[model samples]
Target: MRIDVHAHLWTDGYLDLLDSYGRTDTATQRGTGAGATAQELEARFELNDSAAITHQILSISPQVPHFEERAHAVHAAAYANDLYAGVVADHPDRFSAFAALPLPHVDAALTELARALDDLDMAGAAVTTDVLGASLADPAFTSLFEELDRRHAVLYVHPSGHDAGTPLIADHHMRWMVGAPMEDTIAVMHLILAGIPSRYPNVRIINSHLGGALPMLLRRADDQYQWESPQTPDKPSAAARRMWYDTVSHGHLPAIRAAAETYGPDRLLLGTDFPYQNGDLLRRAVTSIHDALPGQDATTVLDRNATALLNKA
Candidate 1:
C-alpha cells in the first residue's frame, strides 16, 4: 500500500478568502483541483489503483494568502483548517489532513497549530517556503519553530509565490515547473545554513519535490560551507540527513536517483502532488521510483516511510 505524503484540496471558503485578498494567481485562477468532489477523489483513487495508494494526506496548496494584515491571514488560516478538519472527518479511512498556519504572524500561528493538532487532530502543518517574503530561518520565526519542536510536530515545506524580479521560463508558462522547485531549493538551503534541523531536533520536516535542487547542490553547499564558515556547528549534508524528503520529482529519474542517493530509502516518502499531477502522472511517478530502486527499497519509499512519519506524528 502506498501512503502519499503530498496531496492538496481547496475549499470554497478558502478560495473566497484568497479572492477577497486579491491573491489570484494562475493556480488560483485555474482552481488547481482544489474543489474536487468526493466522486472525483474516488475516481482518482481508481485511476491510481495500479499504484496501490491506500491513503493520502491532504494539504492546502501553496496558493495560500500570506496576508499583509495579520488578522486576515489568521482568519483565513482558521477557515482553511476547519475545512481540512471536515474533509478528514468525512473520509477518515481514505484521507488525513495537515493544517495551514498564518505564518510570520508567529504568535497566531502557534495558537492555530495547537488547535489544529490537539483539537482538530490534523496530521501536521504545511507551510510555504517563505512567509510574506521572510525566509523560514528568519529570527522572527524562532518562537514558531520552538513551538513545533516542543510538540514534535510534522512540518511539510512547500514552495510559495516567488518574489524574483523576472520569471524563469515565463514564455513556456512553466513558472510553476521551474520557479516553485527553485524556491524549495532556496528555502531548504536557508534552513540548513541557519542550522534549523540541528536546532529544532525534534521537529520532523518533510520537504516536497525531492527537496527541490538540494540533492544536486548539497555537495556544493558543503564545499562552500567548509571554505566560507568552517566554524559552523554542522556540515550542510549532515544536517540534511536529519530531515525527510518526499518523492515528488514529477517522474524525473535523475532527480529521484539523486534524492534517493543523498537521503536513502529510509528518508524518502511517496508523494503524488495530486490534482496538480492527476492520477496517471502520480502512478507513473511511483512506477518510476519502483523502477529506479532495488526491491524493498522501492516498497520502503511507497509505504514504510510515510507510515512511519504519520505514526511519528
Candidate 2:
C-alpha cells in the first residue's frame, strides 16, 4: 500500500476556532494554504481526482507563528489540537493527525503535548525549526524535547522562514522558493550541532521538502564539521546526515535520485505537500524514487519506510 506520511488538512470552521486568537494572517494569505484542514483536503483530493492516495497523515502549517504571547500561544495550540482531534475522529481510516504545539512556552507546551498524545491520541506533534528566532535546541524548550523523546514523539520539523535579516517576504518570489529551504536547513543544522540527536534519541524528526537543501549541502555540512571545532563538539556529524526526508521535490528525478544516493533508502519517507502542490506532482515524485531504486529498496522508499517511520505498521 501507498502511505503518504506528509499531508495537511484544515477544517472550514477553523476560522471560528481562530476567532478568539484575534484576526491574524494565515497560510492561505501567503498562497501556500498549509493551514487547510482534512475536510478541505478531502474536497481538494476529490477535485483533483486523486482517489489513489489511500492513507495520509494530516498536519498543520508551522509557517504561521501564533505564540507571540504565552497565553495566546497556549490557547492557539489547544484549539488546534481540538480541531485536529475532531478531524481524525471523523475520518479515522482516511487520516491520522499530528498535534500542533506552542513553542517557547515549555510548561504550557508540555501539558498540551501530553494531552495531545494521551488524550487526543495523535500520532505526534509538529514543531517549527525555531521559536521566535530561538532554535529548537534552546534550554527553554529542552524539557518539551525531553518529554517528546521519552514519549517517543515524532517531531515534524516544518520551517517557518522566520529569519529577520533575509525575511522570506522581502525577496518576493524568493519567500518559499529560496527562504523556506534555507530556514529549514538552518533549523536542522541547529538540531544536529546542538546535540539534539544525542539528547533525545527517540524523537523522530520528519524533515519536509526533501530535507530542505540538505542533500545539496550534505558534503559541506558533514565535511566542515567532521572534526567539530568550537562550532561543534569533537565528533563526526553523521547524525545530521542520518535524517528522515520526504519526496516532495516536485517531480525532480535527479534531485530525488541524488537524495537517495546521499541519505540512503531507509532515511527517505513518502511525502506529498498536497493541498499546496498538485497531488499528481506528488505521485510523480514518489514514483520517480521507486523507479530510481531497485527491488525492495524501491518498495521500502515508497511505502515500507514511511510506515515504519509513522508507526503505521
Candidate 3:
C-alpha cells in the first residue's frame, strides 16, 4: 500500500481567484485543470495506480495569498481549505488534504487553522517557507507554532521561489530548479538558528525537495555551531534530525539516499509533487528509493512512515 505524502490539487474557484489576480503560473494552471472534473482527477489516479500509489495527501502549491491585504488572504485560505475538504470528501480513500492558512495575520490564521483541523478534518496545514517577508521563526508566529505543537500537527513546508537571491544562471529555467531549493534551505536554516525545533519540539515539519540543501549543509552548520556556540545544547545536525523530509527530489537518488542516511528511513516520507511534476517522475522516485535501501527500509519510506505520521496527527 503505497501512500504519497506530497501531492497538490487546486479547486476551479481557487484557480479563478488566481487568474483574477494574474497569479496563474504553469503549476497553478495545471492544478486548476486537474481539479476541474472527476475525469481529470481520475486521470491523476490512473497515473498513481501505475505507480502503485494507494493514497495521497493533497496540498496546495506555494501560491499562498500575499498577506498585504488581510481580507483577500483570509478569504482565499478559507476557500482553498473548504474546497480541499470537499475534494477529500468525494474521494476519501484516494486522497487526504493539508489545509492552507493565511500567514502574517496571526488572528485570522489561527481561526482558519482551527476551522480546517477541527471542522474540516484536514490532515494538517501546508505553509510556505516564509510568511510574506517574515521567517517561520519570527516571533509573530509564536502562538501559531505553539498551537500547532500543542495539537501535534504536521506542518508541510512548501517553497515559494521567494527571496532565492540574484540568479546567476537564468538559462533553462534555472531560477525555479535552483532557486526553489535554495529558498527551502534558507527557511530550514532560519528555523534551526532561531531554535524553533527546540522550542516547538512537537511540531512535525516535513521539508520538501529532500530538505533542499540541508543534507549537504548540515555538517557545515554543525561545525559553525561548535565553533560559535559550543554551549548550545542542540547541534544543527541534531536539530535537523528532529524534522522529517519528503522524497521529492525529482528522481534524484543521491538526494534521497543522503536524506535517508542523515534523517533515517523512519523520517523519510514518499512524495510525488503530483500535478506539478507528474506521476511518472513520482514512480521513478519510488523506484529509485526502493533500489537504494533494503526491502523493509524501502517499505518504510514508501508507506509506513507516512502512516505513522498520519496516525500520530
Model 2 is weakest, by summed lDDT over 10 consecutive residues, at 25-34
Question: Which parts of model 2 are misplaced by more than 4 Å?
Answer: 12-24, 27-51, 63-65, 163-169, 226-231, 234-237
Per-residue CA lDDT of model 2 for 1-313, tens digit only, reads: 5677678765535544455566444535343444455455556556334535557777776533256688877877887789778867876777788888876777888888899999999988887766777877787888887898898888887766554237445556566667777777778777778777777888888888777777788687667775554466423346664568777777777777777887787888877777666556655756677667777887787768877877778
Compute each candidate's TM-score over C-alphas.
Answer: 0.93, 0.87, 0.93
Clashing pairs in 2: 9-36, 9-37, 9-38, 10-36, 10-37, 11-37
Model 1 worst lDDT run, 10 consecutive residues: 163-172
**Residue 125 alpha-carbon offset, candidate 3, angstroms:** 0.6
- Best by lDDT, which number? 1
- The lDDT-based order of candidates, best leading, equals 1, 3, 2
Point out the higher-scoring one by lDDT: 1 or 2.
1
How much does candidate 2 score in TM-score? 0.87
User: lDDT per residue, candidate 3, 200-258, as tens digits?
Assistant: 98898988888899999988888898677564568888888889888888887778888
Residue-by-residue lDDT tens digits, candidate 1, 87-122? 789878778888998867888888999999999999
Q: Tell me how candidate 1 scores on lDDT.
A: 0.82
